[model samples]
Target: MWKPILLILLMIFIGVVGFHIIEGWPFLDCLYMTIITIFTVGFKEVKNLSPQGRIFTIFIILGGVGTAIFTLTKLGEILYEGGINRFLRRRKMEKKLKSLKNHYIICGHGRMGKTVRERLEEEKLPFVVVDNNEKKLLELKQTYRCLYIEGDAAQEEVLNKAGIKKAKGLAALLSSDADNLYLVLTVKLINPSLFVLSKAMDEEAERKILQVGANKVVSPYKLSGLKIAQGLIRPTLVDFMDLIIRRKELSLYMEEFTVKRDSDIVNRNLSECDIRRTTNVIVVAMKKPGEDIVFNPSPDIKVETGDTLLVLGDKEAIDHFEKSYLGGIS
Candidate 1:
């Protein structure tokens, strides 16, 4: 529309100027003649046309009519394709969100939220994102091929739509600490056992979020500062630890398991329990109820029900231990 309008205006300008120069006609007459000629109205010319005026009329008709057709075609194509593509994408996201369960909901798409999403992707965890910024949410959906909800995460309705009640965990990384606090509190109220990790801008905010029942509170600035110091002090050790934490194949996660009362290994020593012999996992530490953790416990240390074992091994070994001793796998 715009291009065609501009083209017509330019043709009129040329015609008016040409008539005034060659035929000595007034501006109004030249303008009237230009409009009638371009529309093929075939009205009488304002005055007798010189050969120069006839040539200018031919150029005007060619340029104006072609531009009008091109502009209309492009506009029609945009309306036809863009609208349908947007609708289909929205429908797909809705369907994906509806079927989600045991999935994570990331409240923000900022730095912390993006990092969390990447880590979850590395671990093959399912998740959906929520952000008030529609452009950012669309960008995330395109980049990660994940479902996203464009809304305020602190709102109860938005949380419910994200399946907060069925979610296994959530990460609150909204720009404002207060918003994260509100989200944590709301989620906790809705599902008391849903694990939540939230970001805090400062120590006070961190404490507030924890008080609101967030399972963990992370401060990116503080954590980054500590990481920088560790990198300088123990670069090699830090690198090794990062490898383990970031590795996907080994999946060597540190999981704590509490011995069950009826387990067969309830009264056996660590060596006699045969976790190392049977599952090839190391019991790095043991923490008795109400007691501090003991690291690298001696093999002779007695394993009892209610003692929490901090084990480190690949997923396969962990699975074997959970099945053989814990009675069922997590």
Candidate 2:
């Protein structure tokens, strides 16, 4: 913006001085003549020009032409790169939110929500975030590829825009317990089956959240205290667990996969399946369909439909099980 203005000012200053020296014209007349010449208005020159004035005119043309070309090129680049298209895309996402279904609506994108989003990303879960802060939303969009609806999470219109009716779950991590409780109640009223995980600031709020139909209520402060104590008492174990949870290279995660009727592992015993040998994953527990959980089950225990197998493994091993053992081929 300033570049074009500066270029024009420089041209006009040069033209005024040159014209005064060559034709003895006033500053105003020289300025007008310079404008007309640069704009190619074809106006008559105020007076005849000397050799110096002609050279000055050449310089003006050279500078003005380059400036004009640069300005036009920048404008073209902005349009070509879809600057306006991206704005329209965001508007479209907002419009499309009204009809979204089977989506997860996340209220608040703070620390807890960030962790939840990370886990969701690992599982490739689709979700939309709602927050009042535009700056925070911008930062989140830049860091994590996800849809966002900017508004107060407690409001019905905001929740509706987030497609709460179609949403399978609502994770309310609002800073306040009262807000989370209100959000939980609203979500439950809108969709009775919608699974809700709310944040509670205290025990009283935790109880209220449960009463309001929140599937789970987590208190960050309480959890942090426990974690700190655990770190002090069992530092080595905590460090190892943290490494598994936080390190992308290790990519270790605990996952529970349910066996479907058609799953290849439905009728296979642990020994016969040889998952440990094949996938290098540890079978931590086998949760039977209608029986107690078998922690560290023996090799002879048979896998069955509707049973969940809790395993600890790297992402690659989990991917293999999800593909080869589950229905997914890749």
Which regions of candidate 2 fall more than 4 Å away from where they truly are?
A: 1-3, 6-10, 13-32, 40-47, 71-86, 91-103, 118-124, 141-145, 165-168, 258-281, 286-294, 297-308, 323-326
- List RMSD in Å for every model shown: 6.2, 4.3
Error of 2 at 209 (Å): 1.1
Best by lDDT: 1
Candidate 2 whole-model C-alpha lDDT, 0 to 1: 0.80
Model 2 lDDT at residue 190: 79
lDDT of each residue in 110-167, candidate 1, tens digit only: 8778788888887778798889987767676555377788899989999999999889
TM-score result, candidate 2: 0.75
lDDT of each: 0.84, 0.80
Q: Looking at model 2, which ten-residue stretch has the lowest summed lDDT?
A: 1-10
Model 2 Cα lDDT, one tens digit per residue, 103-156? 788898887777787777776777888989777687765543777878899888
TM-score of 1: 0.68
